[model samples]
Target: MLTVQPLQPATFPVPGQFYMLQAGASYDPLLKRPFSYLSAENGSITFLYRIRGKGTRAIAALREKETISLIGPLGNAYPVPSGEFIAVAGGIGIASLFSLFGAATGRATLFWGGRTAGELLMTETVRGLVRTAVITTDDGSAGRKSLVTEPFREYLAVNAHLPVYVCGSTPMMKAVAALCSDAGARCFVSLEAYMACGVGACLGCVVKIRDSENHEGRFRSVCKDGPVFDASTVVWEGQ
Candidate 1:
């Protein structure tokens, strides 16, 4: 977890929106990395990220008062659910969905899963905010040993009318989207892509989306058109 306070008052990012962060003044890493806002309040923004590669390693090395460049509150936000909704998060993907709990107040339920207990950051914080939170770990170190989708599928069998919000690994989102489609529920997904430009200019971060009218597929820029999209509209891999 890293928190940054801008020198000037900052715009609070809507849930599911992300920022492109470039650590330090050097351009050795070249492209900025995208991270969804964990929370934004009182001119301070927080991001939850794992040190997976060079970009993240740079971010991890920053000291207090060091300067970094940021370009966002970018991409679309998840729709505010008017009724009860379920959120499915895989590992650190919870970073994007946490604010939705506040948006829905007592009407949200969260199904969160990680490969191990260590990947499940802020579990207690999430439990405090949602109506109910079901946790699962692949290793069975905490919660159930089953995939997070298992309990979500079971829940939908009973509460099929509720909408779903999802953010996770690509495979997890695709799986959850399939389940929602089968249950006749609406599902929104937050996508991750490599971005050369955080804005739309570079055309580097595109995903296939199926046209609603003709069913033809077209590429859309994830940086601008979404990081958040309706699950049914996305042309998942192998589709």
Candidate 2:
């Protein structure tokens, strides 16, 4: 919702792509985290992040006019949904899934989960684009006192044919994928791994690939090859 400049392709972003930010002393390196593009337009990239640890908190304090260096718009996007779609997110993962709204221009719903109402992000931003935008707060502070996957499953029960997209912490993404697999719905999941470099050469973001059928071919770099991946391609240890 905050705009710093007019939209430009170089500055705008595509879904599933990410940026490596330089957070100068206004922040501690320990507090600068990589973020994926939410929705980019008018020479601006929109981002939604929770102010959890110090890094993100520092990012929240930055002034708009201040500029930062970033390297990205990397990784392939989830297969665009054809008919209808559902997106499930936890915490600020909406920053990762919100961009898919345009690609899912088909029809859609969003199921978001948070520890409390205060942690919710992108509800209005996404609701403005999709048909159903549901927010579930764990402390009963917002929409429903439930995890995001609850509504995700309930919605899928009735809309079994819908495609699902999910993003969040590792545990949440794993759970959503498991649910989608059980219901026979195709799913896509965005990942989060520690990264120092946002490109493949560093080999810093390796993840275990989980699904046998989908991961048939090879290994992928979250920074270069991903951050976004098919649910069936991740090997989640459930940590």
Candidate 3:
């Protein structure tokens, strides 16, 4: 968990929107890393990230009040659900969906799952914001001993009319989207991709999108067109 306060007040980012962050003045890493806003308030923004690589390790080493480069509230945001909706998050992917849970207030039911209990950060924070939170860990260190999607699928069986919002590992999102498709539920997914440029100019972060009419797909810039997209339009790996 990292919280950064801008030198000056900035616009709070919408849920599912992200910022490109470069740790120091020197560009040792060259490209800024994209991180979704966990929460933005009171002139500060928070990001929940795991230190997986060079970029993240560099970000983790920064001292308090050190200067860093930030560019964003970038990409499209998740639409606010007008009625009751389901939110599915996988591991740290909850960072992108936290604000949406608040946006839906008491109407959102959250299904969050991770391989271990430690992977599920801010469990109390989620419980405070959502109507009902279903937690699962593969190791059974926390909630049920099953995949997060298992409970989500069960819920969808009973209430397929509710819309779903998801952010997670690509495989998890693909599986959840498939379940939603079978259940006739609308599913919106927030995608994660390696980005050279956070803006649209580089054409580095493109994903295949299935055309609604032809079923043929076109490449769309994830940075520009979406980090959030309708699940039906996305061409999953096997499709």
Candidate 4:
């Protein structure tokens, strides 16, 4: 996790919007990596990333005063609905919802989960923004010993009027969407895709979205059209 004070364009970052970052000063790695803003306050922005590859390893090697290039506030942001909010996050997907938590007052509730307690990052910061927060882990190392969906289901039963917002693995988002559908609630999902251009030109990060006029549906670029979308608009793998 790194937070930096950007030299220009200090404002207008919303939740779910991402930036392409390149930590290296040389062209050795050659491509920038995309990360959603974990939090942006005053003039500084934070990014939460796991050290999973060479690009990240290169990022880890940065020293103070070293330069980093970024192309950003890219992609669409999560919609702010009128009613209460139920946020569902899996693993580092919490990055997509933290800003929303900060913007909201008493209307948001976050359900965050991970493989273990260690992966559940920024719990204290998130807890300060929402009305209620529920944490779960697969191994029962924290909060509850069940999937986030379990508590989400329970919350949905009593508060079906609220809107649900999710950012996580594909299967988890799909499951949350289905659960919302079954409960007659509105749901929004933020997708994670392998984006090359961060813009629509490359045709690299397309996802199937329903076309009301054409039952067969169509493909939309996650970077250009959205990374955040109405759950009902997404055409899941089988359907």
The numbered model that scores best in TM-score is 1
> Residues 1-239, candidate 2, lDDT per residue (tens digit)?
32334333474566777776554465366423578777777567766655657666556667878665566666667777777788888887887777678776586788888899877865676689888888898899999888888888888888778888888878888898898888888888888888877777778788766455565445678877787787876777743
Give me the runs in candidate 4 sitting further than 4 Å from their true place.
Answer: none
lDDT of 4 at 93: 93
Off by over 4 Å in 2: 1-11, 25-27, 30-32, 210-218
Clashes of 1: 0
Q: How close is candidate 1 to the true structure, as a TM-score?
A: 0.96
TM-score order of candidates, top first: 1, 3, 4, 2
Off-target runs (Cα >4 Å) in candidate 3 are: none
Ten-residue region with minimum lDDT total, candidate 3? 99-108
User: Which candidate do you rate higher for TM-score, 2 or 3?
Assistant: 3
lDDT of each: 0.90, 0.74, 0.91, 0.86
Estimated TM-score per prediction?
0.96, 0.86, 0.96, 0.94
Residue 231 lDDT in candidate 1: 95
Please identify which of the two predictions, 1 or 4, would achieve the higher lDDT against the true structure.
1
Q: After superposition, how far is residue 153 of candidate 3 from its true place, in Å?
A: 0.8
Q: Determine the C-alpha RMSD for candidate 4 after optimal superposition of all C-alphas.
A: 1.5
Tell me the lDDT of candidate 4: 0.86
Residues 145-207 of candidate 4: C-alpha lDDT, one tens digit per residue: 999999999999888888889999998999999999999988999998888889889998899
Better of 2 and 4 by lDDT: 4
**lDDT by residue for model 1 (61-111), tens:** 999988778888899999989878899999999999988888764478899
Q: Provide the lowest-lDDT 10-residue window in model 4.
A: 98-107
Q: Model 3 residue 160 lDDT? A: 91
